[model samples]
Target: MPHIHVRHYPRNFTEEQLRAIDEAVTAAVTSTFATGEDTVSISLEPVTPEDWDSQVLAEIAARRDELIKAPGYWNES
Candidate 1:
């Protein structure tokens, strides 16, 4: 099974956009891991912008090296 979790700021995306995101994420995971789209699971987590640093960025930074796809914005020196 391939599980994908996407975290983003609340109210930034519409329903159609989220659906597109879910489709794209499913395609990516299925292609990358050779898994069926039916077996892939995607979860979208919405967090407030004010809590982004502590809720998302901090966790990603702490495990940066372990991330398969790290955000480019966080890679700037």
Candidate 2:
């Protein structure tokens, strides 16, 4: 079982864009782990920029070492 969670700012992505993201992410995960699409799960969360520091950044910072793929933008000092 593979579970993937994607969090991003909800600026102005259309429904098609979000669907595309879901497809691409699922494909990547499936390809990397050699899993069936039916066995993979993906969830997309939209967080506001204002609350990113408290909601997302804080959690990431706490588990930084555990993250296999951390975004470069958030790592910049």
How do the predictions measure up, each by TM-score? 0.79, 0.78
CA displacement after TM-score superposition, residue 11 of candidate 1 (Å): 1.4
Q: In candidate 2, what residue range of length 10 has the lowest lDDT sum? A: 68-77
Write out the backbone clash pairs for model 1: none
Name the TM-score of candidate 1: 0.79
Candidate 2: residue pairs that collide: none
Q: What's the lDDT for all of these models?
A: 0.84, 0.85
Which digits, one per residue and each the tens of the lDDT, describe model 2 over residues 1-77? 89988788976779998789878988998999998889888777889999999999999988988988787778645
lDDT score for candidate 2 against the true structure:
0.85
CA displacement after TM-score superposition, residue 9 of candidate 2 (Å): 1.2
Cα lDDT tens digits, model 1, 3-75, are 7777888766788997898888888888889889899988878899999988898999888788878787885
- lDDT at residue 46 of model 1 (Cα atoms): 87
**Model 1 off-target regions past 4 Å?**
12-15, 75-77
Residue 73 lDDT (model 2):
71
lDDT of 1: 0.84
